[model samples]
Target: MELLAWGNTELDSSWSVTEKSNCSYIRIYHLTSGSICYSDTAMSCALDTEAVYILPSHAPFTMKPAPGTDTHCTWLHMNIYPVLVKELLSIPYTQKQALLFSLMRCIMEEAYPPAASLSHCAEIFIQDLYQMGCLEKPDPAFSPVLDYLCVHFSEDISISDTARQFGYTPEHFIRKFKKETGSTPYQFLTGYRMGKCCELLRKGYPVSSVCALTGYHDIKTFDRAFKKYHGRTASEYQKYFKKIYP
Candidate 1:
């Protein structure tokens, strides 16, 4: 995970925004004073002061401060894996304040390289959420399949074969996988492969090698899929990151 942005800010009633679609990064908000309402197509909720709100990536919602009130908040924007939890989570602002501020301090302090510290802090926060049972848990029945995919994503494996290997028929497996993961098996496989492709690319691997390593046989096909996933061609993505990091 990477910290994209962090800050404390005060917003007045005049501040309101509608996000008509999912955002690319997760949002973490620690409300210090006043309140805000978050609404989506399905539900609406008010976030009170002294509470922490976690808005998972790819969740579409709108937020506005209470009328005539000023809301003080510390917020973080992070580039992390799409969290399985889709709903906005409101947790009490207790011991977690230390963790959030620690993350901020990781970026603010120049005593040492911050990359490892930042990741460590973020990982702890995420793990805390999991231990608190705030995140969704995958079905135990599908654990083997998930584990298999992690190890064999580079291999060409058919959905039917995978399902049978785990004692599930193709149709039932597809349904269960979709229900548990919010995506079809093929979609999940493609996403996992694309993630690996990104990791390899960021490590300076050539696009051609990344394609084969991530299970693609044809360069053009890999290019198309990578572009669709990342909104940039493989070579362009590598160049873009190089420019930023160099």
Candidate 2:
């Protein structure tokens, strides 16, 4: 995981925001004073000052502060795996606040926070969430394929061959994978690779090395895909993180 941006803002009663959808990063907000009504297609609720709200990637949402009241907030934007969003949301409010505040302090206290320290905190928080039984177990039949991809993502993968190895036909594998994971195998692999690319970049890996580490042999292809996936070239992404934390 990587911290993309952080802000502490005070907004008046007139403040509101509407987004057709959030971008690639996850958004987290803690209101220090007042409240806001948050609504998405699935649910609507008042976000109170004592709680934290984590809006996952690509979710459509809106926020409007209570009438006639000013609001104070601390917010963070981060790059993390989308699969973990569900689990993160399931964590209890107090636990979420504790973990998030620690993360905020790590970034705010230092002129130049170490990237590895941030990554380590994120990893530990994720592990604690899992230990709390927030994650849903994967379907037994699909677990093998998921495990394979997790271990072999840095290798050149062939969908057809992978299906055969796992006792599935390519057509059936595509269908079943989509049914189980809400994404096709290729989409999942690419998403995983791009996420790893970001993590490696934040760890100070050079672009050329990160490309090879993420299994893209062709530099040109990696460059194009990186730009498309992240809205910035690999070098630019690396430089952005360095400028913020180096």
- Which has the greatest TM-score? 2
Q: Identify the runs in model 2 with alpha carbons over 4 angstroms from their true place.
A: 1-28, 33-39, 57-92, 99-103, 217-220, 243-246
What RMSD value applies to candidate 1?
A: 5.0
TM-score of each: 0.69, 0.70
lDDT of 1 by residue, 137-241 (tens): 567777778779868989988899999998899999999887776566776677678767766776799999999899999999999988876668999877865
**Candidate 2 C-alpha lDDT tens digits along 127-196:** 6656876434447778889879967998989999999999999999999886665466776778778878
lDDT of 2: 0.71
Provide the overall lDDT of each model, using Cα atoms, as 2-decimal numbers: 0.72, 0.71
